[model samples]
Target: MVEERADAGLYGPDSVTWRIHGNQSMALAGFRALSLQAVHPLVMAGFNDNTVWFDDMWGRLQRTGDWVATVTYGTTAEAEKAGRVLRRIHAALPPGVEPESGLPYRVDDPELLRWVHVTETESFLSTYRRCGGILRPGEGDQYVDEMRASAELVGLERHTVPASEADIEDYYAYVRPQLRVSQVARRNTLKFMLPPMPRWVRLGTPARPAWAGMVGLGLAMLPPWARRLYGLPGLPTTDLLATANGYAVRRVLSTVPLVITSNPAYGRALRRTRGPVAA
Candidate 1:
């Protein structure tokens, strides 16, 4: 655990991922990117550090009483602007690599495009909403319309139509591979290396033996108050500090053992060395 934390701190900057979406008009792009870089130094200085830049922001938002900050949008205007920026960025991505099977994804591929739309929009909106933004009181429909429009702006469409099941399916298939890649990598990585994980790796809660199997039957047998009582123990509010601190500890531990190796680039440079010349 100690070594993991040390390695994490050592490599923090290269690994942090909280980059601001690029936009010429918004100074936020530069600031956000730098802030992402800054986290590593802070980690080295013994401050709490997040594994990722976005994770850092998410943690901050959650601490500020907006647990859903990642998925809710507060104002339509903000959402629109953000959506536009994302569209431009996506337009600029290089066409994706082809898989061994030869299927390929272009930046504008419907499935890939739509998933980006939904994800970024959802992330910004969730944070906004958690911080007290919502669909305009009487303009809920307008908000939905704007969201759909934004989705379309990014080249996302249903089977070449404005709306239809075929289009949706086409879009889903395109993005489904991306989702599978993300989910599988996440699950497999965790499970594969799980044995080495320390005991404090946030198992969350140990369910009582009775609740472990046949959920419907077990829950049905419990009185309503008992069920509620059981749930209360798992609520985030109760053990907030402990959970937060434990998470910090585990994150630090997970990256430890400073197995520093010379950079591959250094090796390349050495190959060009011709008998140590003048200092």
Candidate 2:
């Protein structure tokens, strides 16, 4: 029997979490996740309060990506440690009320976390399938099931999160009536589309066009209803073009060596877990 090492982390190398989160496409799909999450006024309000200036935009996201990387690829202990750090940070944030609804909010609230979690995994699955990553038959559902481990890490009750695409769609149905772009959400959308870049890159390189195009494609990959919610034209034609572009982007990214593309924590985990599993 090919037994996985005891220290293979929460989901191990064979997991859907690793496959999705480890991909370069996840970086591209991140805008979709953030865009969808911001439809909730409270979620958007929380993000609005934490807006990073200048290059800090990417810096903050990089820190988040590192946390995800550690959670996905670190040893079980390491993964739990990363989760504790996040919970502590979330706990420390002051609670606020949404101005319009007067609904008080906490970032660590389980319901809010569930919304974030579902939208995030939806974005990942959509990107994976549309960007040429294969999903055979029931594996999509399996992917959803496996991600409960992550939900548990982020202070969510695993049973409360969606465990399949159908469940995700149903949750969206319930939340759809409440979804709208508040002023905060609108600002969140704009910044996500135009993240800060160093002056030289902005002026000299094709950075603005390149980055905007990628963000646009990410937005296009969202469900038609979601794209419409953002006031973007969600024509099937747009999806056709975006899918082609995303496929090309994924292919190009795949050419870069794993060592170059994967985060250092992931690299170390692979080294620790590869080959010769002791029962």
lDDT of 1 at 144: 31
Root-mean-square deviation of every model: 20.1, 2.5
Per-candidate TM-scores read: 0.29, 0.91
- Model 2, 1-279: lDDT tens digits are 766654888888888777777777886778778778888888877766644533487778888788777778888898899889889989999988887788888888887898898998889898888888887798899889888888999998888999999999999999888777788777666776777777999999998998888877877887888889889888999888888888899898889998887668767777888855575
For residues 1-279, write the lDDT of model 1, one tens digit per residue: 122111111111221111111111111112211222111221111111212323354354333222111112112343345546656765675554333234445554564444444433333332222222334453322333334544554456533432332343454455433322222222322232222323454354443322222132222222222223224233345334333433343344336542332223222222333233333
1 Cα displacement, candidate 2 (Å): 16
Q: Deviation in angstroms for 65 in model 2?
A: 0.5
The TM-score leader among the candidates is 2
Off by over 4 Å in 2: 1-6, 50-55, 257-259, 275-279
